[model samples]
Target: MSSIAFMTQAQEYMFTYSKLFSHLKQNVKQGHEDVKVGLFFLNADTKKNCVIQKAWMEKEQHYEELKTTRYNELLLPLDDNLKSANPLVFVRTPQDQRCDFSMVVMTKQPLKGTVSYTEVEMLLPQMQVMLEDLGGMFASWFTPDVEGVTLEFQGLVDGQVEFSNGKTKPIVNGKAQVALSDIGQGGSMILPQETSRVLPYLPRAD
Candidate 1:
């Protein structure tokens, strides 16, 4: 039988908040209000398991790391909240699936002085609930695709292969295939070397 398999390869995906920043800046300017920025994995199923590799703010030649209090959350520093900084997050999901991350830039009442860790910890539960509620409103504020090359395979038999997103697939017949929607870029799927040979072909739309 001929099949196409997806092999896991630890792919890196980036989440950015350029549009969210613009929206928040305008709101802050008009209302003369302080705003807080946060990043969250809104999907209940994958939020906890998702691994955040790194996060940072970028503007021209300057880049600074953004600290995370938990695996699922990253609250922006209050000193220069969103000023001209573009936030970027590098993450790896446990498996190849739809990305459900959200960027939340909400108006916040100003707090005096610096915020301590204890205060932040206490506020986390409320923040989580609020962010999740706002997620759907700003769903289009960022692009939700994983960056990587796509490959295809052919002339394979029943077996299993790993995927870049850390998920494995079992090839039932020589015809198991990965859906195009599951993969952003167009190309073919990658298969294990020992199982079968693959042929490269033009990508087709789902």
Candidate 2:
């Protein structure tokens, strides 16, 4: 349901997309019996702030002021795996404030078998686009510390779905992996120092 990623000087606490999607689906189903929500992709950025106030004495009067200008917020997505209809939620920096993708089945009873085939076909290509954008945008985040680190996700189905944008390979075995650093370096990305700890980092999505 939740996990924590401890960095050299940072701490990231967030939720897993799969679990969140399951929860959402359950809620949606309960809210509307027989209604199934197919979630293809989800990216979101949210900012939250905590204010600290202090009192100071000036001359004979007391004054109160907010102490800091920086704000604190949590960034997370509905899914992390780029699988068929599976939620792929992750966190990223606040610099890019955008919600990349999200899809929901508005009707009662979830789409099944051939009913979902067409939609999946349309969704994979678009997801690949997001993948390329994400890889290039956060290329700098990859360090030797993250060398060989990869992400894989797929949908549970009776058959298979393969997708590629020419630059990347097809999704095989119902799974796909995108090397975060490989995008920027043309297969020449430098590696970070290998260490005991695996730095957990994800670009914030909206």
- Tens-digit lDDT track of model 1 for 1-206: 11112234644345455544443333334232333444554445533324454656665676777666443455454434554454553444455544455555332432223223243233333333333334455633432321121222234445654444455556654433433333223322345542221111113323
TM-score of each: 0.31, 0.20
What's model 2's lDDT at 174? 29
Distance from true position, residue 71, model 2, in Å? 30
> Model 2 scores what on Cα lDDT?
0.28
Report the lDDT of model 1 for residue 120: 27
